[model samples]
Target: MNRRLFPLFAAALALTVAASPASAAAPADAYADEVVAYRAEKWQSAHFDDAEKAQKHAATLKKLGCEVKTGAHGGHTDVSHRCPEWREISLKTHEKAHQWEDWLKANGFETRHAH
Candidate 1:
């Protein structure tokens, strides 16, 4: 951890990230679309920082003709949308976010959600 080599390490990391195929494959909008699809199919849910963002995401789902259901409280901030077709793969009473993806995949759907 020499101070003089910090810049070199950062530059290398930057270059590595820049050259990643995942970074070049799809734009944010495309990923957003995938997330939207997952939500539509009830494969996942999203939690935004504010009500506005939640509503906005809900609006996107609506625009796509999704039938989103908000909590009984009427979307104060935390909204959970359910897809009737959703079949739970498995339930993890306590698991980290990283592990959830694989668990979900093994269950059935191939999806990811935005946090």
Candidate 2:
């Protein structure tokens, strides 16, 4: 009985060792894929000196299918926008921000951190 159980235990240990690498690799592969996807994202951010301009920018980004939010950055009002579905939609949001930036500048509102 002891001899038979020894072989069974050894086999189970061997199997566990053999499966370890594959199980570990799955999460690493998933994290790598997530990193690649995040790197490929086209998220845009802009800073406005005036809260009103940031609000306008946020509204424009919302029209372009982006989820927009406002925050304070370096004592300036900041607006960030992202379209999670596709880069094309985010591109439209970015383009609209550029247009808004140009309009803001023309209207004498200085913009910063437009990236």
**TM-scores, one per candidate:** 0.31, 0.38
Query: What TM-score does model 2 achieve against the real structure?
Result: 0.38
- lDDT tens per residue, model 1, 1-115: 1223324333332332111112233333221221211223453455445566566555533432346655434435544454434222111122322333433343233444344
Top candidate when judged by lDDT against the true structure: 2
**Local error of candidate 1 at 38, Å?**
7.9
Residue 37's lDDT within candidate 2 is: 11
- In candidate 2, which residue pairs get closer than 3 Å at backbone N, Cα or C atoms, i.e. clash? none
**Candidate 2 on 1-115: residue-level lDDT in tens?**
1222333333332332111121123232221111111111245667677777566666644543456778987878877765544211111234444543443333223343223
Candidate 2 global lDDT: 0.40
Report the lDDT of model 1 for residue 75. Answer: 37
In model 1, the runs with Cα more than 4 Å from the true position are 1-39, 72-76, 82-115
